[model samples]
Target: MATYSEEDYLMLSGIQHFAFCRRQWALAHIENQWNDNYLTIAGQNLHHKTDDPYISETRGEKFIVRAMPVHSREYGLTGVCDVVEFKKDNNGTQVFGKSGKYVPIPIEYKHGKEKTNHSDELQLLGEAVCLEEMLFCHIDYGYLYYGKTRHRKKIEFTLALRQELNQTVLEMHSYWQRKYTPRVKPSQKCKSCSLRDICLPELLNRESVNEYIERRLSE
Candidate 1:
């Protein structure tokens, strides 16, 4: 597998889009065109809330919250994580544990309630993959904290998910090599995309239909 530098490739979060729809991913990331909607603005503000540094200790558990810059050389991905939780593992034997064990957990914050989509899950998994490579540990699971529900959902980094994530890494690199701007193909997900206006999938669909008819007539 060919690996590229972090600066040479776009962030791994883009892989989530490639999994959702390749064209959508290219249109937003490659073209660098984005439409700011209320939802995106709200999401930005929500992320801003957690961007700062803070430490909270409660009930013998310590929580350190801060943004993290992550990258994967093998995956050629780079992005920042919203928050990570570090806690000391009390379950350690005296002889075996010279120092107290510390566990690192990644927590991603979303602006909306849980939806019937894998985009968020893939993004989190990508982050986990990067963390695993950097920390050289097996990250078995993480949590997604939904703003709407105001609750955390535990996600297991199963073998299946890891396989899919690896595939995404490969696909994203291939797409970046093409370096062609993607046209919009509207779908249910478009309603929430911040690049809806720039993508204009509906308009592109119409154009495609018209071109098909014209080509048929000429034939």
Candidate 2:
């Protein structure tokens, strides 16, 4: 398997943006454009609540780690997981300095309720891939904790999901290599996009004055 050097690694968080929209990913990652909308601000605040790296707590058989750094050389990705819960299990791998074997379950905190899109799920899976690589263990499941609903949704890390994640990372690296920003395709989702004004999806949708004049001349 191929491995990426530290300099070549991309942000694992970009998986969510890439899954949401390629143009969005290019704008933020390539063009370095970002805007703070209410949704984004709230999301940031929610992350702030859990982004502390020094906190680790033990609850019964579970050891909870916050803001754990993880990376996967195979995917060329690195990021901080919001939470990694190590549940004690006889079948799990032994954690260093811990008494028993435990399963590493990544838990991501989302600001909103569950959406129809797979962006959040893909992001969580990316984190799982990193943990699996860093810990040298197989992770079969993860969780997404939503602030809006105050609920945790479990996700299965299946073979198909793993394949999709690998493909997504490959595409991300290709785009990064080319430094490409894809053209805008306007949609309802644009309304909620943080970089909507900078992306100008609405302007891209409308015909330019020059184009209108050209069409009139042609007519």
Candidate 3:
């Protein structure tokens, strides 16, 4: 049997939650459990919409959408992008007729409306980080194409977001190094989590406290 390294432990999307909530990241990635609800299913289906290969012409620019596999060894993350658009840059003229270059814009499709936080932004930013490292270029912005609003919202990859992304990568590495699974910290988000059944946070908490009391009595 082949042994999986700690580098193989990180999930690309997990970095998002690790930034939002460390416990949530550990629950999903470390525990190996997930429970899919209607929202998650709908979001997944939205991604499927862009999974196929297709090209579109818009205002003299060609947009090629592809489901590309992306990975970053530096961040220890790997995942697939829903749609990556390549636009030709005709500004610099030197090598090949105004030098057409590839500018990668990763579009993430979500099922629900935008949230009042940076969770979604962080996720997209993580993808941008991976793309930047892979492409060796500055990706200034990307779009979050939402199904609910039926529009594409431009996201500026700010310095703060980049900092958060770096912090998330470091924390995920630390969490993945731990041998024991973390205790569940349940919240309303858990209701939407697919791992609720397997996690059994409420039950686990009760059992843990009971065992602690029993051990004290025995002592």
Query: What lDDT score belongs to each candidate, Candidate 1 first?
Result: 0.71, 0.88, 0.69
Candidate 3 lDDT over residue span 92-190, tens digit each: 112223236666777887788887778888788778767776776667788888899898899999898889787877767777787344675677777
Q: Name the regions of candidate 1 deviating beyond 4 angstroms.
A: 53-61, 90-99, 182-185, 202-219
TM-score of each candidate?
Answer: 0.80, 0.90, 0.78
lDDT of 1 by residue, 1-219 (tens): 666775675676676667677776777687655567887788788899887656333335545557788888877788887887665665411212335655567888888888676777888988887877776666778888888889899999889988888787777767678776556446787777776665656566455433544676999
The candidate, 2 or 3, that scores higher on lDDT is: 2
In the predicted model 3, the residue pairs found to clash are 34-194, 35-194, 35-195
Query: Which candidate order results from sorting by lDDT in descending order?
Result: 2, 1, 3
Q: What lDDT does candidate 2 reach at residue 15?
A: 94
Question: Number of the top candidate by TM-score?
Answer: 2
Weakest ten-residue segment in model 3 by summed lDDT: 90-99
Q: Candidate 2 — what's its lDDT?
A: 0.88
List RMSD in Å for every model shown.
Answer: 6.2, 5.4, 6.2
The number of the candidate with the highest lDDT is: 2
What ranges in model 2 sit over 4 Å off? 202-219
